[model samples]
Target chain A: MPPAALSVHLSIGQAYAWSVFKPPLESALGLSGTQSALPFQLGIVMLGLSAAFGGTLVERNGPRWAMTVALICFSSGFLLSSLGAATEQYWLIVLGYGFVGGIGLGIGYISPVSTLIKWFPDRPGMATGIAIMGFGGGALIASPWSAQMLESFGSDSSGIALAFLVHGLSYAVFMLLGVLLVRVPRSEKPVESAPSAFEGPQVSARNAVRTPQFWCLWVVLCMNVTAGIGILEKAAPMITDFFKGTSTPVSVSAAAGFVALLSAANMAGRIGWSSTSDLIGRKNIYRLYLGVGAVMYGLIALFGDSSKPLFILCALVILSFYGGGFATVPAYLKDLFGTYQVGAIHGRLLTAWSTAGVLGPLIVNWIADRQEEAGKSGSALYGLSFVIMIGLLVVGFVANELVRPVDVRHHIPAPREAADVGARQQPESA
Target chain B: MSEHDSSQSPPDRRPLIALAWVWVGAPLAYGLYELVQKATQLFTG
Candidate 1:
C-alpha cells in the first residue's frame, strides 16, 4: 500500500518543483513572472476542484480504476504541455498542465489514502505519513533532475518540450507499477487491541461534512497550509533578501541549497511527526504543529537577519510543521469520522488546500512586492508577512483545540442493522 | 494437479513484494543522491 501510494505521490508532487520551469518558460515564451505562475496556480485550483468533485466517483470506482485514470490524465497533461512548448503555444501549456493535469493531481492524491487507513487501522497516522512523505520528497528528485534535463537539452523551447515529453512517458510507466500492485483489504478485520479513543462509530461522507468538527478542521488545514506556503513560495528569494547587506551575502546557489534543506525537512516531518502522532494522539500532535509553528514564525520575524544559523533552524522547524500538518490530517480525519469513506472525506477537505494555494502565495508576494516598492530592504521586506503568518497559526491552534468526537446522530447504522432495514424495506424480495 | 496439491504448493509472493519495494526504493535512492549533491554545493561553493 505504501509503495502504491508512493508511486502516484512522487509523480504528482512534481507540482512543488514547478518553479524550476518558470525561468525557462519566461525566457522562451517571453512571459512575465505572473504569466509563468498562471499554470501552476491554475493547476492547484484544478487539484482542489477535481478532488472535491471526483471524490464520490473515486469512492465508487475503487483504487485501481482511480489510479489508472490518474495515470492517463497526468501523463497526457505532460504530453500535451510538451506539444504546447514545441509549438510555442502558451495557452496549451495552461490547459494541459494546469487544467487537465490538475485533475490527475486531485484524484491521485486521494487514491491510496483510504486503502492505507483500512489496512493499518492500528496505526492510521503512520500509514498516511508513509504515503504523504513521498509527496514532500518528490520535489527533491524533480528539482535537480529537471534542471539537469534542461541543461542537457538546452534551455530552448525545443528542449523544454523534450523534457516535458520524457516526464510524461517516464511517470506513466512508473505509476503503472502501483496500478498493478495496489489492493483493497479483503475485509475490515478487528484490531487485536485498539489503543486510541478514535475507534468509534462510522460516519458517511455526507454526514461527516455536516459536523462542526469538519468545519473547524477545514479552518485549521487552510490556515496551516497558508502559513507554510507563504514561506515556501518565497523561500529562495526570502533567504537572499534577509542577508543582502551582510558581509557574507547569501548567494543564489546557497539559496537553492536552503530550498533543498526545506524539502528534506518537509519529507522528514511527514513521516516522523505523523508517526509520533500515533503515540501522542492526533489532537496533541497538531497543538505542537500549530502552536510551535507560530513561535517559529515569531522568531524569524524578530531575530532572523541577525544570525544565519538561527534563521535556518527556525525555517526548518516551520517547514517541518507545514509538512506534518498535511500528512497528519488524513489520520486526524479518520479519528474523527472513522475509516468509512475517508478518501471521499479527505477529498472534500482538500478544498482548504486549494484555497490556501492562492491565499498563501498572494499574501506573501503582495506584501513583499509592496515592501520593495516602499524601499524596504533585507528582512524588513518579509517582516509584516511573518507577523501575519503568526496570527494565522494562532487561529489554527484554536481550531485544533475545538475538535471533538462526532455526534451519535451522524453515524451510519451498523451493518447488521442496515441489512435488517434493507430486508424490511424490500418485503417482496424477502 | 488436484486442488489439494495446488493448495499445498502456493505461489511464492516474496519476489513480487521485493519488486514493489524496488520500485519505491530506486527513486528514493536517486532522490537522496540528488539532495546530497545539491547540499555539497552549498559548502564547496
Candidate 2:
C-alpha cells in the first residue's frame, strides 16, 4: 500500500518544484513572474477543490478505480501541457498543467490514505506517513531532473514541449504500477476502538461537518499550515535578511542550502514524527507540535539575529513540526471520526490547506513589503510576521486542546450499518 | 523452484516485496543524495 501510494505521490510532488520552470517559462512566453506562477498556484487551488469534491467518489469506487483515474488525469495533464508549450499557447499550459494536472494531484494525493489506515489499523499514522513523505520528498527528486532537462533542451517551445512529453510518459508508466498494485483491503469490522485508548466517534462525513470537532480540527490544520508556509514560502530571503546585519551574512548558496535542509526536515518529519504519533496518541502529539512550535517561533522573533545556528535550528524544528502536522491528521481523523468515511473526511479537510496556501504567503509578503518601505532591513523586516505566526500557533494549540470524543448521537445507530463500509465483496490482496 | 512461487507453498513473497521496495527506494536514494550534496553548502558557505 505504501509503495503504491508513493508511486502516485512522487509523481505529482513535482508540482512543488514548479519554480524550476518559472525562469524558462518567463523567457519563452514573455511572461511576468506572477504569470509564470499561475499554473502552480492554480494547481494548488485545484488540488484542494478536487480532493474535497472527488473524495466521496474515491470512497465509493475503490482504490483501483481511483488510481487509474489519477494516472489518466495526471498523465494527460502533462501531455496537454506539452502541447501547450509546443504551440506557445499559454492558456493551454494553464488548463492542462494547472487545471487538469491539479485535479490529478488532488485525486492522486488522497487515493491511498484511507486504504492504508484500513490495512494497518494498529499503525495508521505510520502507514500514511510513509506515503505522505513521498509527496514531500518528490520535489527533491524532481528539482535536479527538471533543471537538467531544461539545460539539455533549451527552455524554448520545442525543448520545453519535449521535456513535458518525457515527464508525462514516464509518470504514466510509473503511476500504472500503483493502479496494478493497489488493493482495496477486505474491510473487516470497524476497527475495534477496543482495548486501545484512542477510540472515539464514528461520524459519517456528512454529519462530521455538523459537529464542532470538524471545525476545530479545521482551524488547527489551517493555523498550523499557515505558520509553516509563512517561513517556507520565503525561506531563502528570510534567512538572508535575518543575518545581513551580522558579521557573516548569508550567501545565496547558503540560503539555497537552507531551503534544501528544510525540504529534508519536512520529508523526514512526515515519516518520523507521524510514526511517533502512533505511540504517543494523536492529541498529545499535536499538543507538542502546536505548543513547541509556537515557542520556536517566539524565540526566533526575540533573539533570531543573535546567532545563526540558533535561528537555523529553530526553523528546522518548526518545519519538522509543520511536516509532522500534515502526516498525523489522517490518523487523528480516524480517532475522532472513525474509519467510516475517513477518506471523504480527509478530502474535506484539505480545504484548510488551500486556505493556508493563499493566506500564508500573502501575510508574510505583505508585511515584509510594508516593512521594507518603512526602511527596515535584516531581522527587523520579519519580526511582526513571526509574532503573527506565534499567535496562529497558540490558536492551533487551543483548538487541539478543545478536541474531544464525538457524542454518541453521531455514531451509526446499528452495528451492521457500521460494518457495511468498504466491505464490498471484491477480494483485496493487501 | 524460483524464490518467488505463485503456488501455495507459503508463496515466499520476500523477493517480490523486496523488488517493490527497491523500485521506490532507488529514486528516494537519488533524491537524498542530491539533498545532502546541496545541504552541505550551509556550513561550507
Candidate 3:
C-alpha cells in the first residue's frame, strides 16, 4: 500500500518543482513573473476543484480506478503542455498543466489515503505519513533532473517541449505501478480488535462537510498551509535577499542548496511529525505545528539577518511544520469522522490547499516585489510577510484548539449502512 | 488460510515483496542522492 501510494505521489509531486522551469519559460516565451506563475497557480486551483468534484467518484469506484484516471490525466497534461510550449501558446500550457494535470494531482493525492488508513487501523498517522512524505520528496528528485535536462537540451522551446514529453511518458509508466499494486483490504473488518486512537462514529463524505468541525478544520488547514507556502514558494530568492550584504552573502548556488535543504526538512517532517502525532494525539501535535511555527517565524523576522545558521535552522523547522500539516491532516480527519468516506473527506479538505496555494505565493511575492521597489534590502524585504505568516499561524492555532469530536448525529447509523450506501452510490468508471 | 499455512503457502511471494520494495525504494533513494549532491554544492562551491 505504501509503495502504491509512493508511486502516485512521487510523480505528481513534480508540481512543487515547477519553479525550476519559470525562468526558462519566462525568457523563451517572453512572459512576466506573474504570467509564468499562472500555469502553476491554475494547476493548484484545478487540483482542488477536481479533487472536490471527483472525491465522491473516487470513493465510489475505489483506488485502482481513481489511480488509473489520475495516470491518464497527468500524463496527457504533460503531453499537451509540451505542445503548448512548442507552439508558444500560453493558454495551452495552462490548459494542459494547470487544468488537466491538476485533476491528476487531485485524484492521485487522495487515491491511497483511505485504503492505507483501513489497512493500518492501529496507526493511521504513520500509514498516511509514509505516502504523503513522497509528495514532499518529489521535488528533490525533479529539480535537479529537470535542470540537467534543460542544460543538456538547451533551454529553448523545443528543448522544454521535449522534456515535457519525456516527463509525461515516464510518469505514466511509473504511476501504472501504483494502479497494478494497489488493493483494497481483503476483509472490511478492522484489523485491530482493541480500542485505537481513532475510535469514533463513521461519517459519510456528504454529511461530513456540513458539520462545523469540518469547516473549522478547513480554516485550520488553509491558515497552516498558507503560512508554510509563504516561505517555501520564496525559499530561493528570499534567502539571497536576507543576506545580500553580509560577510557570507548567499550566492545563487547556495540559495539552490537552501531549497534542497528545505525539501529534506519538508519530507522528514511528514514522516517524523505525523508518526509522532500517533503518540501525542493529533490536536496536541497541531498545537506544536501552529504555536511553535509562529515562534519560528518570529525568530526569523527578529534576528534572521544577524546570523545565517539561525536563519536556516528556523526555516527548516517552519518547513517541517508545513510538511507535518499535510501529512497529519488525513489522520486527524479519521480521528474525528472515522475511516468511512475518509478519501472523499480528504479530497474535500484539499480545497484549503488550493486556496493557500494561491494566497501564500501572492502574499509573499507581492510584498517582496513592493519592498524591492521601495529599495529595501536584507531581511526587510520579507519582514512583513513573516509577520503576516505569524499572524496566520496564530489563527490556525486557535482553529485547532476549537476542533472537537464530530457530533454523533453526523455519523452514519451503523457499519452496514455505510457499506450498503457505498455500494449503492458507486459511480460509473472514469 | 491458517497462519502457519499462509506462511508456507508460496515461496514466490517473498520475491514479489522484495521486488515491490525495490520499485518503491529506488526512486526515493535516487531523490535523496540528488538532494545530497545539491547540498554538497553549498560547502564545495
Candidate 4:
C-alpha cells in the first residue's frame, strides 16, 4: 500500500501527457495553436470540477478506487480521442480528452496528495510536493515521446489516432502503479515533537470558502496559472511571431524543441521549487512567486522585442515559477488548514485553476488574434496581454497578503471521543 | 498549538525563499528566452 510510485505514475500519465497531444491534434485538425489549446483548457476545467465534486468520494473510497476510476476515465479519453481523430471529429477530442479525461485528472491529482500527507505527517510539504511533482514532470517525458511518434506516424489523422491509442494503453498501465501502491497511514498523530506554530487553525471545506484567506489564495493561483499557461498554450506562435519582422526565423522542428524545453522547466519546478516550501513556509514563498513573477512579465512586456535573449530568459523564469506555484500550493493549503480535509479543500480551491484555464488563453489569444488582424507584427501584439498578466499578478499579490491565520471559530469540533485532543496538547505545553 | 510561536523564523524562511526564487526565476527566465529566440528566428530567418 505504499503511495509513492503509483502516485508519480498516475500523475505523469494523466496530467502531463495530455499536453503532449496538443501539437499533433492541432496539426491533424488544421486548428491554430490557440484552438488546439482548447483541449488542455477543457481538461483543466474538468480537473477543478472533478476535484471539487469527487474529493469526498476519494476520501470515502480511498486512493485505490479513486485511482482505478481515474485510470478508466483517463485511458478511455485517449481511446475516444483516437477514434475522433481517426474520424476527423474535433468535438470528440474535446469530449474525450477534456471532459472525461479531465475528470480523471481531477480525481487522480488529489488522490495521492492527502494520503501522502497522512503518511508523512512530519514532512507534509515535501510529501505532497513529491507526488505533485509528477504532475509537472509528466509533460517532460510525454512531449518528446509524442513528437517522436508524430514524426514517425506523419502528423495525419491516422497518425494522430495511433498516438492517442498508444497514449491510452500506456497510461492505463502507468496509472495502475499508483492504484496498486498507495496506502493510507494507520495513525492520525502529529509528527513534529512540538506541534507546528501554524498548525492550530483547521478550516473546513465550507468555511474555507467564506474566508478572505481563501479568496486571496484563489486570486494568487488564478493569476499565476493564467500568466504561465497564457504563454505555454501559445508558445510556438508567440515565439514565431516575435521574429516575423526580423531576419532570422525558427523552424518547426526547433519550435517543437522549444516546447520540450519548457516542459522540462515545468517538470523541474514541481520538484525543485516546491520541496523548498517545507522550509521557507508557503506564504513568504508566494510573495516571491507573485511579486517577482510580475516583475519578470513586466521586463518582457517592456523590452521583449528589443532583446530576444532577455525575453526568453524572463519567460523561462516566469514559467518555472508558474509550475512551482502549482506544485507548492497544496503545501500552502496544508499550512493554512490542517490535513483533516486538505484534499477536499484543495479540490474546492482548484476552481481557481479552471477559471485561469479559460481566462488566460482567452486573454493571450484574443489579443494576439486581434493584433494580427490589425497588422501588428513582431512583439507588438503581446504588449497588452503581458500588461494584463502583470495586473493579474498584482491582484494575486494583494490576495496573498490578505491571508491570515484561520479564526478558531471556523474550526469544526471533532467527535466527543477526540475531545481530549485539546487536553493532551494543553498538558504537553505545561 | 496556539501557545507555540507559529511565526516563521528568518532561518526557516531563508532556505525556502531561496528555493522559491530558483523555482520562480529559472523557469520564468528559460521559458521567456526560449520563446523569444523562436520568435526572433521566425522573423529574421
Ranking by TM-score: 2, 3, 1, 4
Report the C-alpha displacement of residue B31, candidate 2, in angstroms.
Answer: 0.9
How much is A298 displaced in model 3, in angstroms? Answer: 1.5
Per-residue lDDT of candidate 2, residues A330-412 (tens digit): 99999888877788899999999999988899999999999999999989989999999999999999999999888878876
Residues A79-171 of candidate 4 have per-residue lDDT tens digits of 999999999999898899889888888888887776666555556667766666566555545645677788888788999999889988987
Q: Give the alpha carbon lDDT tens digit for every residue of A1-430 in model 3.
A: 6888898998899998898889999999999998998888888887888888898888888888899999999999999999999999878988999899999999999988987886677788999999899898777778778898889877889989998899899999988888877765433344555553234578989899999889989988899899989999889888888888888888899998898888899899999999999899999999999999999999999999898999999999999999999999999999888877889999999989888988998999899899989998778999999999999998999999899888888988875566545533433232
Individual DockQ of the candidates? 0.27, 0.34, 0.32, 0.04
Candidate with the greatest DockQ versus the true structure: 2
Candidate achieving higher DockQ, 2 or 3 = 2
Lowest lDDT block of 10, candidate 2 chain A: A189-198
Q: What's the candidate order when arranged by decreasing DockQ? A: 2, 3, 1, 4
lDDT of prediction 4: 0.71
Show the lowest summed lDDT stretch of 10 residues, model 4 chain A.
A421-430
- TM-score preference between candidates 1 and 4, better one: 1
Q: Please list all clashing residue pairs in model 1, or write none if there are none.
A: none
Chain A vs. true chain A, TM-score per model, equals 0.92, 0.96, 0.92, 0.84
